[model samples]
Target: MFQSFTPLNDKVRLCQGCDLPIRVQQELPYGKNAYCPRCGTQLSRGGSPSLSGNLALAITCLLLFIPAFIFPFISIHLLGVTFSATVPEGAWNLMSHGFPLLSLLVLFCSVIAPIVLCAALVVCHLALHKHWFTGMKLGTTIIYRLKPWAMIDVFLVSVAVACFKLKDYSDIIVGPALYALIVLQLLSVLLISRVSLRRYWEAWRPEHTFEHQSKERHCIYCHLSQPVGTHCQRCHQPLHHRKPRSLERTLAYLLAASLAIFPANLIPISILITNGQRLEDTIYSGVISLFNSQMPGIAIIIFVASILVPMAKILGLGYLLVCAHWRKERFQRQRMKIYFVVKVIGKWSMLDLFVISIMLTLVDRGQILDFVPGIGAIAFGLVVFLTLLATESLDSRLLWDNHPNSPTSGRSINER
Candidate 1:
């Protein structure tokens, strides 16, 4: 049975400031702070302005969320006839076109997910506003659940693709909803950056007091707080204040993702035929053709989603991992930064996947021009999937080893 620590122990080995248990021992030269093993309550800590900033941004985002959904995202003009799509309209269009799967995908990615995410943020803000620190556990869980499903960025990529592909046939106009969507995305990022969970935990620990007693402090992992301990049962390490393997694993995943990217992009993604003429298009070629056909805006989008964004994800993850591995990085504060970047950018790589799905459904005009996904589509999908996995595998805690007062639990290194 799993057990968490409590203040009930008679011989309390309290955290220096908070009077909570020293969950684990600290290594020398770092002077790590001890924490309550169960609740992760810090013994002593200082407040940060970031918490207030995060709350403000979260509230602002909630206000923007309404307009983002209520307005039309894009308008299409075909030979003096005009059609516009709200997020839901786009879904209906796909469904009416006999692409039910793609329709649902669009609806969920563009509409449902964004709404849920914003709502979760609002709830979190309210909880924080009410000073209900205990409620934050639930709010954080909701936010984490919403993270993967919030696909506004991915939807933006799809819209850009659609704009490019449709440009040759019609006039495309951006709408209020599109700008709202952009603002919503920006606000979400700001909210994520402004909050630091660790710092929050430190500041809002449950009010409790424990009297310090003189007994040997036991390690949470090894069950032995004896001086000069050897290994921990949790992490199974000669205990150090920092995670040893986090940097290496992060770097390895980053490098692997970088290596796989070349093949993913260089390959041909689709073959398009117009007027009974066959034309092979790589990802770049397809975007070029879109621009040559007077869809520069769409071309820019394609380049961003299919090429630049994914590369940025790989490079950013790589840089963070390398920095963490060197021990030169300040892990605690920066850990959230790395985590936010990875979580937010992970789904954007699905842009190519969305493009493939859309093209497969929309370009089947029987006798005029036919489009079929090529090898590049499959490869690109795999790369995106793998990179997402790599991002998930990275441990954000690796960045905090240098913190002067980190917790001592063997489990601390493992905590997200």
Candidate 2:
């Protein structure tokens, strides 16, 4: 009953990564994958990806959510006093401290986004399974949009870092919720990677497969070739040759991130007061402090995720933007590689923020050992968010638009 979209031999599949139009095999063997000849982006993988299996995975994640977020996640014991908080409680702690923005951020990323992502996938697969097309499209959109922001895995990593940082001063207790969260994170990863968006689009409208001969126009989302200026029949997005205003938007985000990065690194991100003596730790100073505490490994991670990554994203995105704007052809492959790296590592930079959120809940004993967030935390969080936007807004296709050997280089505005 599950009919796969089998394209004609002459049909062209557009690479969403670099926008290269490639003529792929009509039916690839199971367990094999096709890669774009130019940019090496995975074009298609051969498998009977089941809708029911994906639905089951999503449902399991949804059920696991209660234990992952509701119950005690982690606890700390210091000075003969014990304090424990759930995932949501940590966010609430931040909100109670007047940092509502960061609190909302934690809630959105750790709670709302994951819930929405799982729910969306469940609905999408169910709609497709039941042949109910109406909600399928909306579900598909929500799933992809929420995937990046669902930082359950990142938050878990942050938990590990938090544990490491606090182990020296306190007895850290791992709760059942932490184990549930870990399991939830693993399942989420598998579900996301397993459910191919293109596969869904193909299954939704098998007739829209690349049956046409014209390579002039195509839909980047569903990869269906269509007439000029028409919306994609499958995904309903406008058929643009390139994402409109890609470079300009990328530049704006990068500029804003660049401005924020300074204050983020210069000012103290957190303040610690003990016995009425105060000490402030900037981003750099925090790394050094971690090193002084014999946590060189964590210090390096903090340095890379907090300090090095933000700077690299700004500089890397700027380089790509300049090259794309001027249509520079040399090292287009290398540029694409840089873009991929920037996109992947964008979320991990929030490690410090997550660490701070956990630390606040653990070390607030008032004058004996109080940890208060500083203005720099706000600026640093902004840098993470803005860079993520910059990475998403820039069209990778633009990088290939000016290459001499590029398939889409000659034509300025017609397809995909």
Candidate 3:
């Protein structure tokens, strides 16, 4: 029911996805969506955040967050013995068993990072509502940085895989923490979706006095517009229209990740030693084993998480780089869409590492059933990390830019 925002500064909006700058369109009174013309990405949903409403969800998220770790996550009964684990216990178990680095990775990505994300959203939303403008900017930047790394969703998937893997051998019982995690993850997703960043940008929108658009350098990370070569006023980061060295860094990471993939696949990732019988698994062989065990659901998930995601990320990034380097302007939306998907789903390849962590904690039966990390697991982890870096560095806007006939070509980017 809100009218179109008309700022006194005549602020120009840049598409975060495709980088095409455009005027804001008024939403249809019927509540139809407003979208970027160049890329058809959603600009707004014809409404703003209900500060109190979302703040309550944020509070609820924080409330549920602890229960997700405090209660038992899963209980396993095998061979007349019972084992159980809580959320924090899993990572600490890893640390106690000689995987200190992995302990940190899991603890940070799964627990601390997500908690900080929820808290940051709370601060940002509260700051916006209270007219605490600078804190809002700072909190928004923190959310953006932590957004990808706060991987509760990935950890949840790992939990599911662990359950599937052990179900055949153990009587798997779901715990209250699992339910709590589900609700917490769901709430976090909803809270993020409910955020209207357009509102925040408008709150921080500058009354630009620059005579020309080229003189307006915008920091892509925080969307702060400023004079060229100076630090951002709000985020204090460097200002640039295009991401710095987007292509060069992407290529470097892509090549390094590709080199690691060979050893990652050729070597065994993990070994299962049960009752003196040894079974080794490469990434593909693990998938095959899952399939052979009649656990096709788990098999498909592992295949997608471990194999398809990395390939999609690497190949999709490679294609984007090639298209950008060649200045191929055809299908700009499709390329940008591919880039968007890669940026999101690519990081989930870390699900494999998460699964490793959970298994290492949950499946140690001492001579009966012990899980050992192989050298290949290390290499595979490198591939996941490197490809994630590559995809993140590959700016999607490059897919739309540098084109001879593109709308952005020969235009003053700083102009309103």
Give per-model TM-scores.
0.53, 0.92, 0.86
Pairs clashing in candidate 2?
none
Model 2 bad stretches (over 4 Å): 1-10, 207-211, 365-367, 405-416
Instruction: Report, for all candidates in order, the number of backbone clashes.
Output: 5, 0, 2
Query: What order do candidates take by TM-score, descending?
Result: 2, 3, 1
Candidate 2 has a TM-score of 0.92
Question: Which candidate gets the maximum TM-score versus the true structure?
Answer: 2
Pick out the ten consecutive residues of candidate 2 with the lowest summed lDDT: 407-416
Cα RMSD of all models vs. native, in order, equals 10.3, 4.9, 5.0
CA lDDT, candidate 1, residue 326: 74
lDDT of 3 by residue, 1-416 (tens): 01112342245555666655555443333355666666666655655456567678878989998789888888887678777777777678767767676667778778888888778878877786687877787777777777777787888989999988877767988888999999888888887777654455555553343333432454665554344576765556666667889999999999998898889888998888877889999999999999999999988998998889888888988998999899886887788788778877976888888888777767765838778776787778788878978977877777766644454422323211
Error of 2 at 186 (Å): 1.1
Q: Give the per-residue Cα lDDT of candidate 3 at 376.
A: 84
On lDDT, the leading prediction is 2
